[model samples]
Target chain A: MPGMDMMDMSLMQACMDACAACEQACTVCSTQMMDCGPACMNCADMCNTMMRSMMRMQGMTPATMMAMLDATVAMCQYAMDKCMEHADHSEICRMCAQACKDCMDACAAMRESMMKMAS
Target chain B: MPGMDMMDMSLMQACMDACAACEQACTVCSTQMMDCGPACMNCADMCNTMMRSMMRMQGMTPATMMAMLDATVAMCQYAMDKCMEHADHSEICRMCAQACKDCMDACAAMRESMMKMAS
Candidate 1:
């Protein structure tokens, strides 16, 4: 929480909301039994982890926060890439991809703010 | 599900129970504000993801299952290592470390059975 005191609560709230929405979208998309299912499952887990970590700030160090954020970004990128492959034909995939993008952007913004606060 | 028809439901059930238990333990331990908190947080997410993925096998491939198992193992190992450092001082850390070990073993067994069934 050392670097998080200056973090805007609204941004954190938005990030958590995006993460939760992305998890739900990915869960539904994974149930479609598409090739993106595995990526969606992975992304959902990462997003949930990111959300819960944000909720429990006392449990994190700046190092761990950055690591978790990096992992989440990677997972979101992978999931979004996979979903985009089928986005043209599947509405669920399209929605999931959008959710992943939103979550990724939120997380990136959070990370950027943390870095700025640290510096 | 192609290779899962022969999976022992009892073993799968036991592994899922272990994962759920580990997740709970880790979540509680993380609130202790120890150095292990971050690791515990990561492990909790991985365990929950593992449990849910098992429940929804229709959403997974053998490759994804193996990847998830591997990630769970790594997370459990990391969390257990961190918690063990404080096990001598905190009952919660001790219990959490034990839960992580149990979950890791169960996941490994599940992966082993999956391999045998595949062969």
Candidate 2:
């Protein structure tokens, strides 16, 4: 078996942490009964996927990794936007926004590391 | 609402597609009763999460996006490896491996597009 790279390990750890946080946040945030509920629900699901994927990365190629990242970014982008719309009125929105941001950041870091390794 | 950039949209669409594909593949693969089953179950969860996140991107940021991507890559990497180990003995492993590959490829592409936009 090939040795695990330091950057990869760090990135995966961070990604997993963020996913767990985001899942909890989104789960709580979704119960708020706002328009953002659907978005939160969606974010929760995505975060879970992103986390598990990190946990088991043997199947990942550079291309697939990149594709999943793009999808995550897009979804996070949408969730944050939705949460912001109600931030002034809903605390859940504010929290959900934060989770989204965290998840997005983690995903990006992973991608950067992967690219670095590839190059 | 702020408009979505075309490149972002395209990336998001691809990401969502891959997540969905990966989720379906993983879910089916998990029932195969191989050691890969655990990995497949994990992958299924992650893929679902990835897909949902795309459905709600308003919550995302560049940083969190990166984090999620990293996590997804790791999980896919793991699933692929597990499935490959059983590929010679199980047809389900073969299909699961393909799904993981597709997901990994899609994720990598999405990341590339994002970087292109950022630069």
Candidate 3:
């Protein structure tokens, strides 16, 4: 788009994919209704929003993108932390935690790349 | 939560319910792969995020909530516009468009309430 010419398309694509995967995992994890369910639901929504905003870059500014990434990262971290509490006995929680970690790292990398491009 | 003690719970709950309903409608509409599919998908994600964030008010500041509501409103408006183009030919599009409009109105109301509370 207009303001996205300098963006790394590959990195953005990877981040979007990671967010989608995390959203799916968290959605499934939330159905367990465990202590992490609320956090998982929150993380799922944040990841879906992050992915859609990336896809709809025409509607986003760099500042708003950064803010969204920060929110997504925070949600993923909180969900991951909560999931890890049950990881010892639940395979789904373990997988969900991994997805959240992956999503968090991808969002961080996307944010860093955006900062680099702006600089 | 902490900063939301002065909030209108009934309004917030209504907005959240509207968001959830809009998300569900948009999700179903997007599977049709019509011209409005992308916008429907975007709206679905935004609505889901808006609902979940309302649920997780403990993690939000008034500023972030306002910003998010603005984004959600924009997305819903766009999706509604797109779906309206196909509304005459498609029952699903008509329903989806109605959902988007409802969501947009709900978010606008929520934003106005938040602003009033802040003032």
The candidate maximizing TM-score is 3
Q: Candidates' lDDT values, in order?
A: 0.83, 0.73, 0.84
Q: Rank the candidates by lDDT, best first.
A: 3, 1, 2
Among the numbered candidates, top lDDT falls to 3
lDDT of 2 by residue, A10-114 (tens): 777888898789878888988987877776776777766666656766444456556666667666777788888999988888988988898889888887887
Q: How does residue A22 of candidate 2 score in lDDT?
A: 86
Instruction: Return the clash pairs for model 3, or none.
Output: none
What is residue B112's positional error in candidate 3, in angstroms? 2.2
Model 3 agreement with the true structure over B15-116: per-residue lDDT tens digits: 999999999999999899887887777778778888878987754556657766877777788888888999999999999999999988988998899888
TM-score of chain B of each: 0.97, 0.88, 0.96
What's the candidate order when arranged by decreasing DockQ? Answer: 2, 3, 1
Model 2's DockQ? 0.22
**Candidate 1 lDDT score relative to the true structure:** 0.83
Docking class of 1: incorrect
The sequence of per-residue lDDT tens digits that candidate 2 reaches over residues B41-95 is: 7677766765665676654555555556665666677888889998998887888
Which of the two candidates, 2 or 3, achieves a greater DockQ against the reference?
2
Model 2 chain B, TM? 0.88
- Chain A TM-score across all models, in listed order: 0.96, 0.87, 0.97
Better of 1 and 2 by TM-score: 1
lDDT by residue for model 1 (A6-60), tens: 8777888989999999999999998999989978987787688778878866545
Which stretches in model 3 have alpha-carbon errors above 4 Å? Answer: A1-7, A17-41, A52-119
